[model samples]
Target: MGSLRVYATTGLLIASLSTLVHAAKLEDTAPYPKAEAGFSRQVIYLPQQSEEENFKVELIAGKTLEVDCNRQRLGGVLDEKNLEGWGYPFYRLEKVIGPMSTMMACPDGKKTRKFVPVVGDGFLLRYNSKLPLVIYAPQDIEVRYRIWSASDKVGTAIQE
Candidate 1:
């Protein structure tokens, strides 16, 4: 009985330590540079199962931005700025209004995709893109996001 108790205690310690390490890594990767500039305003549609909901926002270069909506999905391009042909740090999504979905389409028609529900308002996405990362938020709530680049602040976008 003593041996079993010892083993159980050891296992619990290992599990707790692993959880702590994982949490630390996540904290370290959180977005930074609270502000950014060089943004242009644009209108994006959050598609709903019933009807398409539209929201206007300002997109800044080199920063992360997010849209908010519920039962809706946000979809848009990265504009003229191209991340192709150069190695860049993996971009991460810091938060969301709802669930998050991502897709990358090659000029040759190949595509990569992922879908994850936003558990709360604190979900983040991380990706390394050969092309600009195109994202979709599939929920019916306001979306928010942060970029994970040390050299640039998180992108700003105003909702309309």
Candidate 2:
């Protein structure tokens, strides 16, 4: 009878300890805090080539959001002054190339080549609350991004 009581107590103690450990883990790892008005830098590189990559962002009211995509390579130094003068970073690793332009087919079967402001490299957007942004890149390209909050501060250079 005494042995039976000891076994029951030991089982209860083990269960209680397990529950406490689980609760502690939950409290330790919490979700990321919602972004407010601030600047953040993130590097995103895909393992394989993909058609498109999407990123979600939360923008505060009356604040503008600007995203700059910089290709990361071993050699070559990024020109801070040139980037500031150009208003944004240019994806010119091999050579100095401009933004991407594509031709779109109209409903009337007419093809028109128009200049799209945002390239595969980077873009500037304005919105309130949460929004999804998409970017297209080549396979296995190492891309670094700089996100800024507030519209008027778009061209302002930030040292990071």
TM-score of each: 0.17, 0.19
60-130 per-residue lDDT for model 2 (tens digits): 11111221232212222222112343243222222222333234433465333322222222133332111
Strongest candidate by lDDT:
1
- Looking at model 2, which ten-residue stretch has the lowest summed lDDT? 55-64
Question: Using alpha carbons, what is the TM-score of model 1?
Answer: 0.17
Model 1 — which ten-residue stretch has the worst lDDT?
46-55
All models: lDDT?
0.31, 0.28
Runs of candidate 2 with Cα error greater than 4 angstroms are: 1-122, 127-129, 151-160
Quote the positional error of residue 66 for candidate 1 in Å: 43
Q: Model 2: which residue pairs collide?
A: 64-150, 64-151
